[model samples]
Each structure stands twice: as C-alpha cells, then as structure tokens.
Target: MQFKSKKVIYQVFTRLFGNTNTTNTPWGTLEENGVGKFSDFSDKALEEIKGLGVTHIWYTGVPHHALVTDYSKYGISADDPDVVKGRAGSPYAVKDYYNVNPDLANDPGKRLEEFQELIARTHRAGLKLLIDIVPNHVARNYEGASTPEGKRPFGADDDVTLVYKRDNDFYYIPDQAFQVPDIPEEFKPLGGDAHPLSDGYFDENPAKWTGNGSRLAKPNFNDWYETVKINYGVRPDGSYDFDTLPQGIDEEDHNVHYQFWQDKDVPGSWEKFRDIAWYWQEMGVDGFRFDMAEMVPVEFWSYLNSHIKAKNPDALLLAEVYNPSLYRDYIKKGKMDYLYDKVELYDSIKHIMQGHGWTDHIPVVQKGLMDIEHHMLHFLENHDEQRIASPDFAGDAEKGKPAMVVSATISTSPTMVYFGQEVGEPGAERAGFGSPTRTSIFDYIGVPQHQRWVNNKKFDGGQLSEKEMALRDFYQRLLNFTVKSEALMGAYEEIHFYNKEHTPGYDHRLLSYVRWSEREKLVVISNFDAERSYDCDLKIPGHIVQNWALEDGTYSVRDALYGEENVLEIKEGVGHIPVKLEPLQSYIYAVGD
Candidate 1:
C-alpha cells in the first residue's frame, strides 16, 4: 500500500447540519424544532466543506430510522412514542436498510432520490460519502418497506417460536409480552403533550431482545430499549452456529477473505448485512462507518467488508471498535480500513487537554501502534464525545487547538472532525433524550454555534464572532496543511525524548516530533499548558541531521501553520532551532534547504 494524502473526515449529523431553527423546546415536534433536509446540503454548502479540506463527508443518520413523527400518509407506519428515544430517533436504530430518513427529504416520497442527489453533489465537490451501518441492532419495529426487489425484510421467514435460531433475525423471550419502560416523572414522551401513541404501550408479542442485548420483558429506561439486537447465529450458550474463520487467516487481505467465504454457509444475518452494504455501494456511497462494530462478530465483518471491497476496492471501511485487544484482529481479519483510536490516542490526548496527563505518553502510544498507526483514525470530537467547548469536556474550546494539531499531524492515519467542531459548538442544549455534554443524537435540537456559522444557509461565517472565526481559521489552516503535506504522509520520529533531555525548559506539558519525506522535512511542537509561554532551544539529533545530510550552516525554518520564520544553526551534525510558543500554541516548522 503506497502512501496517500491524509484523509480528513468531516462527520455531519445530516438532520442537524442544515437546521437553522433555534427553537430548542425539549421533546419538540419536527415542525416546532425544525429538521434539516437533504436539500439543505446544497452545492455551495458542499463546496464550503470541501474548502475546509475535508476529503469525505460522513452523512450520519441518513438511513431511515424510527422517529416519533407520523409518516403514515407516505405509506410509512407511525412509530410509537413509547418505544422511541426522542422526537427524532437514534440513527443507530435503523428501521429500514434500503431507504433514507423521510424527514430529510423535501418530498417525503422521494427521500431515497434526495439522498442519491446528495451523493452526486458530494462527488461533484470532490468529496466521498459515508453513511452509518449499524449491524449490531435494528429499530424495535424493524421494517424494510422500501427494500429492493427480490429482497425480503429481515426475519420475514424466521421461526419466532424458537428462542434462538441460525436463520432468526432477532432473539426472543417466548411467551412474554413486551412492556413499556416506566417513565420518570419529570420526563414525558412529548413534553406532557397528548398524542395518540404516547400512552406508553407498544405491540410486540413475545418480547424480543433489546438492542443492548437486554432480555428483560420490560427493559430499563437507560437500556437501548428503542431497538432490538440482531441475531448473528451466536447462540445463547456463547457458541457459534456458523463456520469460523480458519486459524491465522487474519493475515490475509480482503480478496483472500472474499474467496474464503465463496463456498461457505454463513448465517442469514450475515448475508442480509452483506446485501445491505452492497445495495448502498450500488447507490453511489463511497463507504460505510460501522457503528458498535465490536458487538458484532468479527467473522461477519470479514464477509461483509471483503464483499464490499471486492465490489469497490477503494471503499473506505471505518469501524467503531473500542477494545484495544481486538483492534488488530478487526483490521487484519475483518479487513477494516480504520478503527477509532478512542481508547489509546484520543483518551490520552483528552486527558492531557484536561490538564491531568503527560504529553510524554503520546510518543509511547504512537510507537506502540507504529505498525498499525495508519489504520487508526484520530479525532478530538465525534457524535458520541462531548464537545470541546462543553463544560463536561475541556470548557474552553481553545484547548482543542494543540490537541487537534497533534491528532491531525501525528501519523499517517486519517483524521476526523465533527461538524461545528471548528466553530467551537458547545453542545450545551438540554435536548430531550440526553444531557448537556453531548449534542443529542436522539433529539431535534439546534446547534447554536453551528447555526451562527450556518448564517441562515449562506454557508459562510457571516454571523460568527471574532474568536469563533479565528478558531475556524486555525482549523482550516491545520487541515489544509495536513492534507497537502508530504511530510505527514511520510516517516515519523519522536523528538520529544531528545528535547526532554537536552532542550532546556522543555517539560512533560510540551511535546515535539519530526516528520520527513525525501523532499520535505517538518518539526512539529505543541505547548499544552494553559498558562506560561515557553522559549526553548528545540534540538534535532545528530543522527537525524546526518541522515538528512544537512551542511554545517544556518538554515531558515518557516512555520507551515502560522508563517513564522526562524533560523536553525547546524554545527557538527546537531541542529539547534530557537522556538517560542505561547500557551496552547502549536508550530509546524517546515525545514528548508
């Protein structure tokens, strides 16, 4: 695999991205809160995103999911408010695999067509499209009303009488009638507003398992009660009913894995998901972001991902597998292109940003995952994580600057930034289903900071404050530089160790590293301290200097990020560069000839 330009994924919650309304009434209706439609992502909007240096747009919640709104007029059944999480449903609780959210279409009946148009628009803007693929579970009332011809909905032929069956799409607690969860006093399905299906009653006989694998007849409100787990041939006794991958087969590529499953007999769920992935690929989607990938079996991924890769060899397959032990297994065997670096890299960076961690630990992590660093996608904010400006996270959005600098330029892996992260969206809305820290994935809420940047659909920062504009400018500079920098796509060497020993005033709160290609060389440094600027002598090791074949003279080094120029004195194969960085400052210096 040759080195490619660094990929920057801009994850946009499709419904919320274009919503301009500020009416944030808790448990508000779609009309009251206002939902962004597929038409909202106009050509100008996509061009602006592309200008921000994004290579792919992960259009979250694009698939048809359960919602509280009544779409019965469009031949879609009304979802019971009792089982739904919020006015807008959880994107992971996909109700239809072959269709898109009707709420996102200007014409309800043309939702799929609208999404297809969005895909074409994204491609025209020179950006790839990524949508969610929740394989672990589906909506409680899973229905494929718009499934393609010759394809049957999941569990259409399953034997519901049996608690566990290889062909069954869902697990069941036989003879037990499903019961609605007990609601808390302060919370109501629709803010105490009366509705036809708000009576806390659902019609699921022989209660199926909850999305979180809860077998209780009435799942706790905190559980994933709005959805049900998909059965993947794993029995209740923890044994697989289907064939497992051969030993040591994880070393093989997707082509070999695709061939391995050629004559194999997989479970019904496996084939169903494989077909679903292929269907989307045929629809012009470039790739998929698999949600909660760890919950599903790795073998299923091997089958699905390999099949998708066989169809489109360049399809980006990103997965959300938190378990560090299973990271390599999923990448090598499951053929995943990237996995979330949440546990090791993101957590470490978050801790450092919170003033409780050491910057020294970052190099250790990078070195530890050196072999698979390219496969680990880094991000400071996503849908699930609290916003950088949120009180629950680093209260100051400026704290994300140095952290993002390290994340984006640390390695050859792809970097992701959530929508409005650049403009410092605090995500402090009360939005019905969840609390303040996270932007509600389950509610129809307005993102204030993002709306300011949206500026009534102008796609410009016309309404943003000076500070917000500066922050966005910082992000644009960093991301654009990252994508076009040859050094970032080349080799990495941690200079933090040498700096900690030889460079005076350099401490654990500061970090330095070097990235170089045959043509370009860069020395990156960051100051994580919230207070106190630092002026130190950043050192380049003698071995590296000799390797780079620098002559014994003073060379001018220019900051690639901020355009600050400095001189580097090289004598006897040791390069000493004078560096001055303010609090929470990052400098990416391009070493010149």
Candidate 2:
C-alpha cells in the first residue's frame, strides 16, 4: 500500500497502454489482432514512459468492458453519422466488476505478473502506477443485459430490485421532491436534428462535450448520459422516471443505485471498490488516479481514502475535480490526497502565455489552490482537454512551446503530463465524452505513427518535443530539487504582490509568488502579459533577500541591500532588486542557500 511521492503522474491511456498508436480500439480483442498480453508489451514502450520525470503513471481506462463488434454500437458509425468519428469503443463501458478485458493480459494471472514486474521496474526507476476505477455506473446490457454468458447485474446479488408500481414506488411517488421540469433549468430547450449528410469532417465543428461511459440504454433514472438512463422513481404502473426528484439535496439525489442496496449500509460500498483497488494494487500498481471523484459521494470516498492508506500510505490519490469551489469539500470529506490544479494551470498558461485577459478565469483557479501550501494535480495539457500546443503554439514552435512547458512545471503542484503531451499531442476533437476515442488523441499513438502524422516540427513524432525535451530536462532539475529538498516540495507559507508604487515600476499583470522553506526560499515570477513586460522586485525577508544566483550557477551579492555574507538589508526602506521580465517570461529564483 505504500504510495510513491505525489510530485509526478504520467497519464496512461488504456487502449494505448503500451503502444504509441493513437487508434481508438476496444480492449476486448487487441490480442486477437496480435498485440499479445499486457505483459508482452515491448520493453521499449515501458522505458519510453519512464524517460519522463514522472514518479507515478496514471493509467486511464484499465477496467473491464464488453467489446462490441457491431459498427453501430455507440449509435454513431460510418453509416449512421459522424463519419469523422473513429470505430473505437469507449473503455468507460464496464462489463464486469471482477475481471479485466482479456486483451490487457494474455492470462489475467500472467497480466498481474507482468504488471507487478512493471511496477518493480518503475519503482527501481523511481516511478509508481495508478489505475483508473469508475464507481458511478456500469455498461449498458452488462451481463444479462445481453446474453447468458455476459449476464452480470448492477450489484452482485440481492442489490438490484424490480420496481413495478407507480403510485407507491419512488419513481412515481408524488411530492415536492419532483418539482423541476425537463424543459430547462433556466433557458428553453433547443430543438435540433442530427447533422445532415455533410461528410462529417467537412464543417470542422468544435469538439463535443464528454460524459462518464456508463450506459443505462433506457430512461430508468435521471439520465446524465443519453445512451444509458436508470429509473430512480419506480411506480406501480410498471413505469419509472429518472428525471423525477427524490428526497435529497437536489432532484438528482434520487440515488437509484443506492436505493437498490439501501437496506444495507450503502456507504460501505467503498469496501467493494476498495477491494478492487487493492486487487489492482496487488497486481503491482503503484496507486490510482481517480476519475471524476467529485461525482461520487464524498462519504464513500472517505472510506476509500482511509482504507487505501491503511494498506499503503504512500499511495497517491488524485481526484479529478475541475472547479475550485468544491475542492475544499472533496479534500476535507474524501481526504483525497490530490486534486487537479486547474487554477494554477489556467493562470500560468492561458493568462500568462495567452494574455492577462485570460486572467478573467483566474479567480476560480486561484481559489482551488487556496491552500497554496499543499499541492494539487497540475498540468498544461491532459487527456481531458486540448493541447497547449494547439492554441498557444503560436506558429513559432521554439519560443511558444518551450515557454508553455516551463510555465506548467514550475508551478507548486506536482505536474501531470498526458500521453503525447510532452511531444505536443493534440487533444481529442471531442472534449468531454466518457471515452475520448474518435478524437485526435487516439489517432497518433504509436511512435512510428506519431512521427509520420504529427504536424509539429518540434517533435520527432515521439512523446518528446525539442522544447518539450528541454522543458523535461528542466523538470528533472526541478524534480531533483523537489524530491531532495524538503522545503521546496509542498505548498508555500505565503504569496505576496510587490506593487509598482513600492518600486520604480511594477505591473499587476505579472503574477508572482514566493515559496519558502525554513532552509531555502525561492521566488516564482511570471509575466502573464504576452505583449508587455514588467520590471519588479519581490519584497522578501531582509536576511533571505541579501544575495542572488542566476541559472548559470554563479553567486552575487545584493549590494543594493548589503555585501556578501553581511546578512541581507531589511532595516528600513523596501529592498528592491530590479527584475526585468519579458513578455510571457517566467523566473524561479533560489533566494537563500
């Protein structure tokens, strides 16, 4: 149960587990086509992932699923519509709870062995493994939903119920709980038909939003996903309505799944999920990177956090919650070890490289990192969104890309680099689906494929870009600093702004913060204004501000304050040392020895 340091996480996409191929293929039958078992993965691939300065690899999409051979499975195909869409099935569709897709391991037992070996190798190389687990729902037609061979129900045994009554059943129970209407929460619902026979790719429409991959295939309960809907309110009339309100925080709190197992302590469900986590852990995984943890009940996660820690305290738990407003609740309730640092990421990248105008979104990001001392999961581009290279690469690969990488890694949180990210992999065309296949992420997986197809000249088509490599080297330096220096590792004591009034000139557009440890202190200054520059000096504790050193490894005295070893000057006026910042340029200065 011991976990790896939370400083690094590598995003491992399921189907592309080892292959560099970006194709969206189902995990059910990869071996039938020749990929062999997960243990059979080429050593070369494992080493490739290890090359990045990552301490843990977040393996996305590793659970079991019923592979579909039908072309019309997901409701879109070459014939139906969305011709631009790829044929890969979403791995989010869970088919079994006790097993993994056969394709992942030649023999499930052998797969575990291989995974164990991988973990050992990772640990030897100083890395950890984290597998993905989905708790919200299961695949449509799971087990009995299809045939005798596949008939697995939602819960193991007595957890499922058949609601046939309307008046008495909660699905049809009339009360104040069922108040909201389907028309719209605020605005009217818009009507539209499917896109016309326009060769899907022609229009180049912006990507579609994504959802968790579980499927109900019917209107049973409030339908978060269109493909599968569960019936939360069951009436005597043999009908059920998911959209109806149940007794809880909101209409969506019906908890149809929980109701199925209500008689028992539903909160304890974490044991089942935790057991699965342990199963993966036993398989030699370093830990787990939870998916949409906020969507699950907080109390349930608390149990999980405690249980996982009991087994392995070092196990890193990264919660994928995007908004900052809810981070405190999740962190407090679930005891989730880490959450995504959407704030620092957006503030540093979009606002800094793009423009201070991007700061419009800074408030949200800032609040999420409110406890700026403890770290949160941070990244520039992950599997969930577009590549920073896409919008900000700004035509010139050299300057645009390198600056972005530097900005992302230097933030306080441990950095997460999604697959193809270091090499400037473009995000999926579809942004928010449970399974992000059909998007560009799936198209450029293999090393050979990426080199030939990736348009960026900076990347040789592998997971490394020239700028990315340089930035990666910088990360290795930072990692060495983070792992070796206890003071620089997690959270800062305080962050202050050195206003222009105190100095010759200062710009509010420049986002700067000071991170310090009793033994060491470093100031991070980022000029968010892509068009303008800022000349400023951070006001620090007099003693710590006495001297400075540049990246070249040379030391100098701050004569303006005091001479070398004379102790820093803080007796009177503001100690201002001029820092000429360029547009979008960022600096990390080590203050004290």
lDDT of 1 by residue, 1-593 (tens): 34579999999999999999999998788988999999989999999999998999999999999998888889998888788777898898889999999989999988888889999999999999999999999999999887789888987888888899998999998899899988786556766678898898899988999988899989998889889999999998879998889998898888999999999999889998989999999999999999999999899999999999999999999999999999999999899999999999999999999999999999999998999999999999999999999987899999999999999999999999999999999999988877888898888989999999899999898999999999999999999999999889999999999999998899999999999998889999999999979999999999889888898999989998879999888988899998889999999999886
For every candidate in turn, the CA RMSD to the true structure comes to 1.3, 10.4
TM-score of each: 0.98, 0.65
Model 1 TM-score? 0.98
Q: Model 2 scores what on Cα lDDT?
A: 0.45
Best by TM-score: 1
After TM-score superposition, what is the CA distance of residue 578 in candidate 2 from its true location, in Å? 3.5
Give every collision pair in model 1.
none
lDDT of 1 at 263: 99
| lDDT of model 1 at position 468 | 98
For this target, which candidate reaches the highest lDDT against the unseen true structure?
1
| Whole-structure CA lDDT of model 1 | 0.92
